[model samples]
Target: MSEAAIVIEHVARRFGALEAVRGATLTVERGEIFGLVGPDGAGKTTLMRMLAGVLRPDSGRITLEGIDVAADPERAKTALGYMPQRFGLYEDLTVDENAFFYGELFDVPRAEYRERVTRLLGAAGLAAFGRRLAGQLSGGMKQKLGLVCALIHTPKVLLLDEPTTGVDPVSRRDFWALLYQLREQGVTIVMSTAYMDEAQRCSRLALLHAGEVRECATPAALKRRLPGALLAIAGSDPRAIRDALADAPGVQGTLLMGDRVHVRVDDGGLRGPELEARLAERALAHAPFETVEPGIEDVFVALVGGAA
Candidate 1:
C-alpha cells in the first residue's frame, strides 16, 4: 500500500452543545479516493473543514502529507485543495476569469497558468463555457467550474464536501469522470457525500453517523461485513413480500428495493427454506427468492441500524 497522504487521529470537534465530530479517525492513502459517507448532521462537513484547516478540531490531530495541520495550517494547506459544499465563486465573473483569479492567488506564472488552465478547462468540459458567467451555468456546470478553480493550483490532495449533492445524474457522472482522471494523475482525493451509489465509486470509505465512525473499509469489504447472506424476493406485491418477511424466523432485516424485497437471512442454507415456508404460510409462496450479494447501502443500513 502507498503511504497515507492524509492522517486523522481520534479527531473531535464541538459547537456549543453539539459534538459535531466525536473521535473520528481515518487515513487516505496517496493517489486514492477516500469517501466520507453519511447522512445530514453526520458531521461530514465539519470533518472535511477541519482537514482543510478552515476549522480547527478541539481535540486530536490532522496531518497532510505528514505535516500537522493544526500546528502549521499554512504549510499543510499548500499541498492540498479544499472545496466546500458551497464553493465561493464570483457569480459575476466569467468562468475563465474565475479560474484566472484563483491561479493568481496561487501565484502560478502567467505562461504556466495559461497552459494548465487550457488543459484543465478542456478536460473538465468547461472550455467552451469559459466565456459564460459563473451564475449563468447550470448546477452541474457550476460544480465543474468550482472543481476547475480548485485544481488551478494543482495541489497534491483534494478535499470536496458534497460536490454532487444537487447535481443532475448526467452531470454527476461527468464530475465523477473528472475525479477518476485526477486519481489517474496521482491526486489524492478525500470527499464527503450522502449518495450511497457515489460511495461505491470510492477506493475506500468511512461510514459515519452522529459524529461517530461506524465503519471504514472498501465498499466491497464493508458489504462483506454484513452479518449474513442477503436474499432478494420478487413477488406480485413487493411490499407484501417485505412485510411478510419483516419478523419471519431467521430473517435479520428486510428492505424494499424496486420490485423486490431484500431480506438478510441469518443463515443462507438454514434460513432459506424457513423463509420460503414462512412466505408460504403468508400466501406469498410463489414469490421468487434467491441469495444475492449485499450492496453498500444494505451494509450501511445494517451497521447503522445495529448501532442505533
Candidate 2:
C-alpha cells in the first residue's frame, strides 16, 4: 500500500462571519483516488485550496507528505498540481500553446515540452486538435485542456475542484479515465464533486455538509452505514410517492431514482411487507419490492438529513 499523502488536522477556514470549513480533518492515502463529496458552498473548494497550498487555513494545519502546508507553502507548491473549478485556458491561445505556457510556468525544459505535450494531448483525445484555438473548443474539450495544463509538470499530488461541473456525460467519462491514468502513474488525487455517481467512483470519500465532514469511508462502508434496508417502488409518479413516504410511520427517507422510488424503512424484517400493504391500500401500484443494499447517494442523503 502507498503512504498517506495528505493530512488535514482540525482545519478551519472562515469568510467574514461564515465558516467555510469547520474543523475538517481527513487523510488521503498516496496514489489513492480520494473524494470530498458535497453540494455547492459545502467547503470542498476551500479545503482543496488549503491542501494545495493556495489558501491558508484560519485555525488548523494542513500537511502534505508530513510537510506543514502553511509553513512551507512555497516548497509544497512545486509538488502539487491544482485544477481549480474555473481554471480556464487563454481563449486566443491554441491547445498546444496553452500546454506550452503551463510547461514554462512549471519550469519544464523547453526541449521536452513537445514530447510532454504530445502525450497529454493523446491522453485527452485531442492529439489532432492541438492547433485549434481554445475558444473554438467545446466545453468538454476546454475542460480537458485545462486538465492537461495542470498535469504539464507531473506533480505528485493532484487537487481538482469540481473538474466536471458543466461537462457533458461523455466528457465526464473521459475526465475520469484521465484520472485513473494519473493514479496508475503514482499520483495522489484529492478531488471534489457534487455528483453522487462521481463520488461513488472514488476509492474513499469524505461526505461534507455545512462545511464539515459528516462521514468518511469507502463507498461500500458508507452505504452500510445507512440505518435500514431499501426497497425500490415503481409507480406513475415516483416523486409523489417519495413525498408521501417522507413522514410515513416507519420510513426513513424516500429517494427517487429514475423510474423507481427507494423507500428506506427502519426495519425491513417487520416493515417491508407492512409498507407494501399500505401502498396497496392507497391504490398506488408498485413492482415487487425487496430488501436491497443502499447506494452512496442514499447514505449521503440520510447522513445529511435528506438532500437540500
Candidate 3:
C-alpha cells in the first residue's frame, strides 16, 4: 500500500493544568474516512486543530499527506480543508459570497473558484440557495453551506469537527450520504464525532478517551474488543434491572439503554437464563432477554467502564 494520508507520532498538547491530548499516535490511510471517536473534552478538537496546523503540539509530531504540519503549516494547509465545530461563515454574506470569501482566503482565483464553487454547491444540495444569506439558513442548511465553503479549494484531506452535532436526524443522514459520496471520489477524510453511530460509518476508528487513544481498528473490530456477549434485558424499570444484574453471576458490567438494560456477561448462553431468573426474583417483568450483538457505543462503554 502507499504511504498513509496522515501520520501522527506521539503527539501531545497541554493547556496549563489540563493536557488536552496526551501522547496520541495513529495513521490514516489514503481515501479512508478515519474517525476520532470520543465524548466532549476528549481532545478530539485539540488533535484536529493540531492536524490543521492551527495549533501547535507541545511535544511530538504530525504529518498531513507527507507534509509536516508543524514545520510547514502553509504548505500543509493547501491540501487540507478544515471545517471546525462552528463553521466561521460570515453571517452577513450570502451563501455564494461566503464561498467567495473562503476562496479568497485559500488564494483560489475567481475564475477557478466560481466554477469550482458551483460544482461543490450543487453537490452539497445548496445550488438554489446561493443567494440566501448564511444567517437565514436552517441549522442543517448552514452546516451544508459550511461544508460547501470548506470544499471551495478542493483540498485533498477534509477535517470535520462534529459536523452533525445538533443536526436533525434526517439532515444528519443526508450529510453522511454526502460524505460517502466524497469518499467514493478518493478524498482522505479525518473527522471527529461524538456520535458512535457516526463513528460506525468510518472505514477505521481511533477511540479517544480523556486525551488518550484507547484503541484503533475497524468498527467491527472494536465491537469485538468488547469481551463477552451482550444481553439486552428490556424492562419498565431499566435502572432496577441494571442494578439487579450488577452482582449477577458472570456479569462484567451493566448499562441502561432507555427501556432496556444491556448487561455484559462472560457468556450470554450460560448467563442469559441466570440473569432472567435473577430479575424474576425481584418481580421485575422484563421482555425475554435477548442475546444481542454489541454496537460501537457498547464497546466504548465497556472499555471506559461505564458511560460512553
Candidate 4:
C-alpha cells in the first residue's frame, strides 16, 4: 500500500480571470486528518473541489492514492466521499431517504446501504430521526445527516468542507467526536474549516491565502513558528487598543481576542514600555502587556491578510 492517500503537484485552477487556486500543492497521508485553514476567497473550496474530482485543475496534476482525478474522476471517486459546504440534501426527504439517495448514487447495493446507513445514523446520533424530514431537522442534525450520506459507501477518503459551521457548541463537540471515531477506523479525512479550534484538531494543516498555500504543519509546530514573542494587553475597546499600537515600532502584528489585544514584538520586554507609551498618548486604559501563547489564528493573521 502507498504511504500517501492524496497527492497534488503544483495544481492550478481558474474561473475566467479569477484564479481560484494558484499552484497549491499538499499531501494527505493514509488515516490522517488533514485540515485546510484559510479565510473566504483563500481558495480552500476550489482546492477541495479539485481533490474531490468535482472540478478539474487547469494545470498540474492531482491523484487520489494513485489515480489521477482529472484524468479519471469516476475511478478516483470510488475511493472518495465529498460533502460540500451546503450538502445537497433533499429538503423534503427523510434522513433515511437522503442516505439512500447517496447510496444509490454511489451504486451501493441496497442490502449494504441498509446496514451501513443504520450504523452511520446511529453513530451520528440520528437513529431516532431517520424518519424525520431533513427540512425539519436542526442545523447540526442536518450536517450530521449529510455526513452520514457521505459515508454511505464507506469510501477510503472523506472530504468535508466546513461541516460544523454555525453549529451549537454541544453539537460541534459531538461532530468532532464523530471525526475522532473515523480517524481511529483508519479513514483518511481532509477537511476545510473557518474555525481555528477545529483546525487544531487535525493531524496537520495547510494554511491557504490568496489562492496559495502559505504554510503547512502540525498545530503545535505552526504556533511555534510564529515569529517574535506574543504579548496581550487588556483594554475596554480591543479595536482601539489595536489601533493605538498600530504605529508602535518593533511590533509585527496585532490581533484582537475578545477584550484583549495580542501584539507580536521583536522583544516583549523592550517593546512593552513603548506599547504602553503609545497607548498612554491616546488615554486608553489598558492593562500591562504580558507574554501570551500564540494561537493558530494569530499565526494565520500574521501570515495571511485578515481584518485587524
Clashing pairs in 2: none
Q: Model 4 over residues 1-308: C-alpha lDDT tens digits?
A: 87899998999999999998999888899999999999899999999999999898999999897999999999999998899999999999998889888999999997787789889999999999988899999999999999998988888999999999899989999999999999999899999999998999999999999899999999999999988999999988889999888668998898889999989888988998888888898899988778989889999988775537
Each model's lDDT comes to: 0.90, 0.88, 0.90, 0.91
Best by lDDT: 4
Residue range with the least summed lDDT across 10 consecutive positions in model 3: 299-308
Model 3 spans with C-alpha error above 4 angstroms? none
User: What TM-score goes with each of the models?
Assistant: 0.93, 0.95, 0.97, 0.97
Q: Regarding lDDT, does 3 or 4 come out ahead?
A: 4
TM-score order, best first, reads 4, 3, 2, 1
Taking the tens digit of each residue's C-alpha lDDT, what string does model 3 give over 101-137? 9989999987797789888888888999989999999
TM-score, candidate number 4: 0.97
In model 1, what is the error at residue 70, expressed in angstroms?
1.3
On a 0 to 1 TM-score scale, where does candidate 1 land against the true structure?
0.93
Worst 10 residues of 1 by lDDT: 299-308
Off by over 4 Å in 2: none
lDDT of 3 at 56: 97
